[model samples]
Target: MTETLDPEDAKIITLARSVRARNGSTEGAAVRDETGRTYAASGVDLPSLQLTAVQVAVAMAVTSGAKALEATALVTEADGPAEQDLSVMEDLHNGTLLLAGPDGSLKGRHV
Candidate 1:
């Protein structure tokens, strides 16, 4: 059965998908802060710097002055989130993580 998502979560899924498509990255991630501000980013691949979508998204939130995160969403084909992704979320706040397929279908969730 398909999982139902809150409207805010659905927005993040859409943002992640757009970032992934725009960058042609393997994965995309979006995070919402306690104040309801959202940040979105795609995986970063560089000769000197390599970061997952979730990592980048979290960093963006932190750099933008987000004290805590309310939720996170990733749009990708991966079966689950990576260890680093979970670490980032833990650093911010213990919140829900929604995983979605490339087609925007809810795949899994972690809290």
Candidate 2:
């Protein structure tokens, strides 16, 4: 976590970590929309379909009528999020994006 991380952002990171642990997934993510609504999801992996945690979280926000995002948090064991994950986050609002390890330590921050 950042030295001055916002409480809301910290909450989303916690939410992401919770879902990751709950689902037993390698990755998890949470997004806060413009309306202050937050969505959390774990990465999906199936024979027919696959999605990164960030992708799933962003999709959830979009499906829930979120016009844009306010913030995003991802918890994963990977060094950082995938390119497509960053792309999807960019496709939405230019909000604060955080990448953290499963232990909740900040790894990277993307706009």
Candidate 3:
């Protein structure tokens, strides 16, 4: 059965795509940071999100970083993102965003 993507999952993909563009790694490694700084040149955000995803997948599968890239690629291709699959993606996206922030973490509640 074809599973419909959850709104949240769709949101994650959208966010990821935006992040990819901001990083400049979507095409060939022109990735940038939130401040528009090129990460490839600075090495602060080494290993693009694509690379990080791979690393996480590998680490989760084998609990090792050796095949992180391979594992992440496999998982991404096979699963993609859907409602049922959104939880993990949300966590991943949120984590990246939080870390990317100026404070490297979310601020206190506004309320």
Candidate 4:
């Protein structure tokens, strides 16, 4: 269920929503690195490439030298974060994962 998000968590959620709207994508995600940096991305689907929004955000964090995540926010119409999305995030570190509706309302949270 929805919890009161601290400013940091709210920031990522906002970023995720902005990306989803701007990209016209079904899913958009943002993650905060342990270093306080944030990365945002939308789902990618091409003939030769496919990645969930969370995956792309995680990749961006890693590519930027993020060793662990502080938190993650995903905004979409889906029921919840996908299984693969959970796996990839756990691979880095155990952090809060927030799932929000397209309207920016929190649907669920996993820790």
In order, what lDDT does every prediction score? 0.92, 0.90, 0.26, 0.94
How many collisions between residues are there in candidate 3? 7
**What are the per-residue Cα lDDT tens digits for candidate 4 across 1-111?**
657989999999999999999999999999999999999999999999999999999999999999999899999998988999999989998599989998888998989
Give the per-residue lDDT of model 2 (tens digit) for 1-111: 456678998899999999999999998999999999999999889999999988999999999999889999999888877898878987896688898898988888888
Q: What's the lDDT for candidate 4?
A: 0.94
Per-candidate total of colliding backbone pairs: 0, 0, 7, 0
RMSD vs true structure, all candidates: 0.8, 1.2, 14.4, 0.9
Q: Give the per-residue Cα lDDT of candidate 1 at 21.
A: 90
In candidate 3 the C-alpha lDDT for residue 10 amounts to 33
| Model 1 ranges with Cα > 4 A deviation | none
Question: Residues 1-111, candidate 1, lDDT per residue (tens digit)?
Answer: 387889999999999999999999999999999999999999889999999999999999999999899999999988999999999899987689999998899998899
Which of 1 and 4 is ahead in lDDT? 4
In model 1, which range of ten residues has the least summed lDDT?
1-10
Between candidates 1 and 3, the lDDT winner: 1
State how far residue 99 of model 2 sits from its true place (Å). Answer: 0.8
Candidate 3 ranges with C-alpha deviation above 4 Å: 1-3, 27-111
Give the number of colliding residue pairs in candidate 1. 0
